[model samples]
Target: MNTKLLFSIAMILSISIITLMCFLSPAHAKSSTSPNIVLIISDDAGYADFGFQGSKIIETPNIDAIAKSGVTFTRGYVSAPVCAPSRAGLLTGRYQQRFSFERNLTTKEDLNRGIAQSEKTMGDHFKALGYRTAAIGKWHLGNKDVYHPNNRGFDHFYGLLDGSRDYFKQVIKKPADKYKVLQRNGELLTETTGYVTDLLTNETIDFIERNKTQPFFAYVSYTAVHTPMHAQAHRLTAVPESVVDPKRRKLIAMTASLDDNIGRIIAKLDQLGLSENTLVVFLNDNGGALTNASINAPLRGYKGSTFEGAIRVPMVVKWPGHIKENSHYDQTVISLDLLPTLLAAANAKPIENTPTIDGKNLLPYLSGANASSPHESIFFKYHSGRAHIKGDWKWMTTKLKQADGSKKLFKFLFNLKNDPAEQNNLLNSHPEKVTELRLEWQDWFFDMPGIWTQL
Candidate 1:
């Protein structure tokens, strides 16, 4: 070969090698040190409502895609059986009862009530690590400014301050209509067009695109299929023909919209080449609600009850390269685990002087590095009712009203592994097991403040 031709070929090979190296270098790829986090929460959703959870009627292709892409916890639970407290537990990584956020806010007088200001939220944890955080959709934590998302670690907030609102309309019909108006950061949006589910999704995509270069924590809280049975008129046609009830059809339509938006968020992540580096978690705030025409079939009771139907929710976590696709974790997991898990994923330490986190970091367990369950037992306390679960055994205490306006306390036990329905109460049969669980529950109960203690 000629000298000139040999030199030309060598130079070409060198250029090609450098190009490949640049394409694979850290500068060209997403930073693994700070993974973006997107937490998508649905309000009052059913356990058996989505395609991933074996639903044949209500199609949730996008949500199912999340399950297909990562791990689905079959025995997932939330700290509370209701909205406000469940969210408190999720964001704080500790039981809401620990901070005296035990019940839902009802009247205008309860405006000041919220997750304790001292507690750090998941957004706080991520923001401390330099993440640009935004909270979209529902903010049922509190109506007061002190408990606002901006004050609770999120940099931007756009959503309702109350627990529920009209999805299509946001006009203030009265002086006490503060919860009806949508707030963008600190400003209240007098008017908003389009459905809320779509609106929230748009904000989420916008946040991701604007902050693609930096780590962002987008909390997409959707109050869909919650109440008033409000859904886009055209979406009703998308519901299955088999669903005859009008209310149920509306709920199905709302769920369909929610699923579509979730798909959009995932698509946005993929489009920005952040899918592999973003941790996306989808779960319901609690379980299906009685008023929303939701179906928590195969599980007993509905929202506000301590049964599996109220507490057990459909939870899926997706981190393209970290969590194995199409994986399933049958052992118990809770919404409280989110903060610790995200912190672990980002290699961020817990905030200084914060209370001990009740949730365990689940990365090791989800990655199969550890075979044992993330928790030895999980406890639940709502009003006079309480429950404790250890291994496959579950013990519960329910408060029932008598004929003469008196309340009666009842105890029940069940081997959840054999009977998940909670149909057979083994309280009498397993007296010793009940004693063990009762004692354990008492210890947990005493450690946390009493109901409305903070108020």
Candidate 2:
């Protein structure tokens, strides 16, 4: 070979070797694993009640920061419109209905049934994968030992065991908040005369600090903006004089406190240099208060109903570098997606080899791996009735018929993608599609007898 040709070939070979070395580096390797998870679940938050969601009301900068840092779900939904069922789905990877969980939760009385250990939780999956798991705030899953957060794979927990409690006083006169002062595992924290948000935030920061060295799964559920709204005087006093109602201002104050708590946690992560290594997710358990009117506007209906406003919620997930920032996705994702999504990111496996969960891993769909939704057909059987989400079409109706086979015909079919307002009803126009969707729902109901609480 000529000397010039040999020299050129050698140079090309050197470039190829350097390129291969760069590809082999750990920094550029394909990753199936992700960062530590910080799932912050807010209680009874509204859909359009945040700054990022075109709301002129609540100023939620910390909430908006999660959206700006990663993807925001335009049509994010919860498993149920109420508290308990939504927690059931959020904690586990399947719809709450699938476990026969209905109603807003009651205490474990003589005959009351609690969340069974038969079904594993997201914490269990992470714990199995060697990640430190801790649950803080609002553990209404159950009151019994079998259903407690400690028994359900949480290494440490600090929060309520009941459904509702006062924020400042942390107790309602009607039902005593024994669950409020109750603490199990980890140090028992007394009511420090501080705000609930601040207390919860401090516990969350402590959990992160304790587990920062190793991968941790922190489930920081906040019982804020629920009812009997109470916040510090300074936070509420900051509101402008013009836009204020005594009761409404109280709600705003509570919301601001929640936002501030989130800000503290984010700041702690940054300060500890664990921000980039954390996959933070923020979402509301269910829709906001109905009669109290937490303001779920532009969407009809309210909490406890199977309407858009009842279950639709604001959702944001942030993971630096992996998930693109400032991205908004319109996919119909539900709260059940959280369990599997977290497990997939953590590379965790299920315990005792339980049956396949109802939720699909939404990581691919969220990270732009595929164009379609993780769920093509989602089911909702609230109480005892049924609802279906197939493609853009939403079909729902009563389970039983009246004496004349025309019972309370609560049927509504809407193409949510085009008419997100749910203004136009096409049940009469699309009887065929309704029939098809109904059959699919029937099959699902029979297959999963747990959809009904009695079953």
Each prediction's Cα lDDT score?
Answer: 0.88, 0.77
Model 2 off-target regions past 4 Å? 1-34, 107-112, 170-176, 186-191, 398-409, 450-455
Model 1, span 315-369: residue lDDT tens: 9998978999999999999998989998888877788867889999999998889
Tens digit per residue, CA lDDT, model 2, 360-454:
77788877788787787888767654678888988875444478877474788888888877889899999999998989988877756543343
- The alpha-carbon lDDT assigned to residue 198 of candidate 2 equals 83
lDDT winner: 1
Model 2 scores a C-alpha lDDT of 0.77
